[model samples]
Target: MELSKSGLWGDQGDGTYINPILPGDYSDPDVIGVGSDYYCISSTFHLSPGMIVMHSKDLVNWSSIGHVVDDITQISPKLNYDKMNHHGRGIWAGAIRFHNGKFWVYFCTPDEGFFMSTATNPEGPWEPLQHIWDVAGWDDCCPFWDDDGQGYLATTHFADNYQMHLIKMSNDGKQLLMESDVIFHQYKGSEASKLYKINELYYFFHSEIRVESGNEVRVVMMLRASSLYGPYEEKEILHTHGEELDREPNQGGLVQAPTGEWLFITHHGSCGYLEGRTLSLLPVTWMDGWPIIGEDIDGDGIGEMVWGGKKPIAGYPIVLPNQSDDFKHPKLKHHWEWSHQPRSDKWSLTERPGFLRLHACIPLEIGNFFTVCNVLTQRAMKTAKSEVIVKIDLTGMEDGQEAGICHMGTQYCTLGVCQQGSIKRLKYNDTGTCSDGPIIEGSFLWLKSSWNLDGIHTYAYSLNGEDFQDFGGQYQLNWGFYRGDRVGLYCYNEKTEKGYLDVEWFQYHYLSN
Candidate 1:
């Protein structure tokens, strides 16, 4: 089945594929190929199950495998959501490589430091994370293990004079030798450094912003040198070629397909949509020695985006990231990553067996609905005309409680059931403004949140699951932090620890980006 038919992106089953092979807010993607299989990781930021790992057979069709970090609390209390706010920061861009029979992933948190994790399998029981470097403010870290077993790690801290460094490291990537060299320091907003040794040369990839047509175009720059240090040649491989339709595609890793074809995977911040940046796969062609990405139609020695093309490696069909839960599984699906590390005791499926039962123990006090800790979220696509619905049982209402659907972004909007004393009212909260509907009789209601590609959102409620009544004004959803918008199902109380809701099902549908 095509990803659209399955409610997401990937495996169109046909010969051709769409732009974002893996859709939603999967920003700053880095991919690697091992043997006949391929794996990719993306920056999850504050979302738990940080640095999501996905697998593929053909390099185009991919699915969520697991997370690099199992215990996010090990990073910081800010990631816990209930403790402090690390909303805009967690894990940034990371590199994935197979070194010495172990799969290694290296990444950094702006506030914390650099960390590495290894796994025997991409779908992992990954080894516990190692904090390799204890320094802060340095982002974009990629690890390289050389042929003679000389290990090196490259990093870029753009905040400090656009400094890029190459550090010597222990073979196992456990210790970071601080004796480093300032490698490349040119270009404004230079970051997302990735290292590759190919054909007896080291090529460092980074994205830089250059003004063209009065716009900050993010161009991909490749630095190459035969020797590890000194006399490096630089060129821009990928960039935005007057993108009025799409933004500039930059900040991704390069990999060769099993069939010996080299390709560049990248992402660009959207101009119109605010659900974060979406992923794009560009075809790479090697001329002379350098690998040029995308199709060189104008023959300017530069490559632009390839909107649609044949799959790089074609074969078996694949599934997409899971959506639309019926609350019947043994546990919550991997598709669901908590806003932070969840409280665990507050939500359950076995308590009622077939419906998701969420206890409103956390106090919201009319604060931002997007800030609540256990708000279960999945990425909203970077297109118009996508909507989600939930069957919620608003029976166990306590005074000053609310629970329902939300469009969580820079400016969030909510349409849910709120309780005041014995009165059960249907409410919509847009930012801080609260509007209410009459008592939702019969204990259960179906709520829906819909939006177009430009992110104009609308909400409705139905006594029966078949029909719905419009209930809220339009909310223009915008991007938040470093990510796009995400639809969330949340429950919380203000007066005290009381109230709960039974979510029978959650369903979503997408058109395109």
Candidate 2:
């Protein structure tokens, strides 16, 4: 049975797919094709279970297979639930490659230097992240292997005037040899480093900004040289083509399909905070040893975004990312990740069998819902209208505990039940503003949150799961911390750890506009 659909986005089931093939906050995507299978990874930032790994047979349809990092705290203690810090600093953009019969992932934190991990299977058992470089101020990094087995890493250093570098590394992808050469330098804002070799020419694909009409516009730029170290020529390959320059499609990977068609898998550069950066698949055309992404709509010899196109590979079952948890499995679904590293003892699926038990504890910063570490979250669908309802058993709730459904981005809105002494009351909170409803006189309550494409949100509560009464005033979703909006379940107390909530199940669906 179909659990959920990607709404009006994704594959159209007619050999045509629309823009934002994965219509969520799947930003800074890097994809690779191995045999008939393709694997893609995206930046997760501070969200735990770090980098998300997606698998696809047809590049237009994807499934969240696994994550590269299981314990984000392994990178730093600040990422732990006790700290609840690093709002947007954890894992930046990384590169995933099938190298030497293993899948290799390399990424870095703004303050924690560089790290790499390896796994034989894409759905792996990935090895613990291995710290490769201890230098800070670097962002995006991608590895390359030459025909002679020489390994090189292409990265961008923010502290050094936005200079992109090419450094030598061990063939095993573990140690950076420290031999570096500056390839591209000193643009307005240059990043997203991807290295590729095509037809005997070394190609470097990165995104940078250009001042247009006094506004900075992000566009994809390419560099090519006969050797690793330049005399490389640079060209602007992809941009908005005189349209809304801010939402340009940039920062992705180039992979060739089984039919020998080169495709660019990227995210729309800047969108509303409500949607974040969404994934888009574009056709890549090669001209004079350079790759042109999207279409040159205005015939300006540059590429522009295409709203719809023929599927790169046809006849694959349309699959959306996992949503709607039944809590029947022993492990959390791949779609779910904590806002930060969660305290393992604070949550469980096996404890209650068919439910997820969240043991409420005082947040490090009491009363701040964003600081609550046990909030289980996933990307909010980038649709005009979407709703999620969660059935929560409030019998375990104690005084000072608030357990409910919430959507978070720049600002947060929550609707749930709060206990004060002996009274269980329905509460709606938009950021720090709280409004309390009538006392909930039932042992079980269902909380619902819905948002529109404009980012306006509403909250409601139901006693019997049949009818819901709207409670909270309209709230607006805002994007912040380099993230799009996220919706999930949160349970926390301002007082003690004795309070908890048993989540029976969560169901999410996209409504027609």
Candidate 3:
């Protein structure tokens, strides 16, 4: 589907919006309302400065605030990306809550147990990750504080032994009291648990991938009770019935407007999306004590997809997440993420003042293209067709140090310039197939990559930043773990760490067919 044509940006600008508020891969979103302010955090698997947190005044327009995991050393040594050990593992789905005049985000790594981080401000200086529980058996945990000041955490056990449990915790949000009561033990692939109190009843929201009519799809599962533990009844309130929405829209958080309007900030999982899972906002109606997302078009209790609708909270100008950067700031832009934790001394924005400099570093062991560390990247939108252009200053590059751009994922494609001593050679590495270009004598070049919505990525280069020529085969985009295509800027040397590359600027333009 043409993402831009389908209104992927969400803001229609007419006091109404489209389905996907976020076109790129901001998956497993959990949001909380702090007065007129709404903050949301997303899953950033294996990316340093993990648990991407953002804030919005009107919920529709959002911007990055900070990250939950700033000191990634607390996770694992393999997160350095040099090892490429944890592809899809680090900081899974989490819950964000505003309590006691503080913002707390609770998340767990599947192998690293439960962790929590808090900040007085959403866009923070979030305190260092508090390793709440160091045992890794369950995930998708949510922290709940009752009226009596008693604290509880709702968690889902691993899929191998699927079960939901409500564990007691200390009011200080520090200690888990061990005491766990099983809530539900029957739903297959039940996860993303959110515990909420509404109308004097405890509501547990989760998603269970179920097989209906021989088709596997995600169904919005909910269970509620009068007490925190036990005797909870289950119901499936939402499902995808239209052919337009091929995947299931589930695994997100519920938001209630100040005016009492309810909306589900959800992510629809497209198993085939190399562009990553997209986020959709759906109006929720409370019927018969059950919250139904989407529109009940067929009069069935189960909700169907709502393509476009009026704004949930209007009266604010359009604001969006960071997309492009010119490398003029003293630090990396909030949109830029390293392939893993980078060697801070190797890359610098202050070194060149206006350009982003990536000092060449030899890999621990050169395996796949992904093994190279400090590759900064941002999400590639599903805009049907898009163009990414970057200016590279190759003057300082030395032997074996290559610097360029690529659409990175499981099976990758790279378009770069490799400098062997003083001779610079242009090349395209489509996964493993190599295509060579003319040996250029210039110390500067312009590189661009354009692709359609179907993921047919094509690379191009220009000597003067004006005349661009396509090079290499059409590299089809692919996924690794839960990640989609990440347009990346990389500089690495397999032989020695003696070279560097300066990215003068980067411009991303989404185009139509």
Off by over 4 Å in 1: 1-13, 180-185, 213-215, 241-245, 364-366
Among residues 3 or more apart in sequence or in different chains, the pairs in candidate 1 whose N, CA or C atoms overlap within 3 Å are 275-484, 275-485, 276-484, 383-453, 384-452, 384-453, 385-452
Measured by C-alpha RMSD in angstroms, how accurate is candidate 2?
Answer: 2.9
- What does candidate 3's lDDT look like per residue over 392-412, in tens digits? 999889998888998887778
Per-candidate TM-score against the hidden true structure:
0.94, 0.96, 0.96
What's the true lDDT of residue 449 in model 3?
90
Arrange candidates, best lDDT first: 2, 3, 1
Over 4 Å off in model 3, which ranges?
1-8, 181-183, 241-244, 511-513
- lDDT, candidate 1, 1-513, per-residue tens: 222223334445787776767657778889898888888899888887788898888877777778898768777777885763778788888989998899999998888889999999887899998988777788888988788998888888766856788888886788888776556556788888998999998888888788866877778888889977858998877767444544677889899987788987787655335556777787999876777888877888877777667888877776655677899988776667778777788889999998998888664334856557578888877443677889988878789888898877777888998888888889988998889887876787999888765678899989988888999898987788787887878888877778888999998876642
| lDDT value for model 3 | 0.81
Clashing pairs in 3: 384-453
List model 2 lDDT by residue over 1-513, tens digit each: 001132367787889887778778887899999999999999999998999999999998899989999999888888889888789889999999887899999997899899999999989899988988887899999999998988888888988788888888886879988855555555867899999988989988998888755767887899899987878899989875332442678889999998899999998766656778888888999877778898887877788777768998987888866798999998888999898899999999988999999999888897777789889988987675788989999999899899889888878888888899989998888889988899988899888888776678888888899899899899877777788888998999988877889999999888422
Q: Which 10 successive residues of model 3 have the least lDDT summed?
A: 1-10
Candidates in order: C-alpha RMSD to true structure: 2.9, 2.9, 2.0
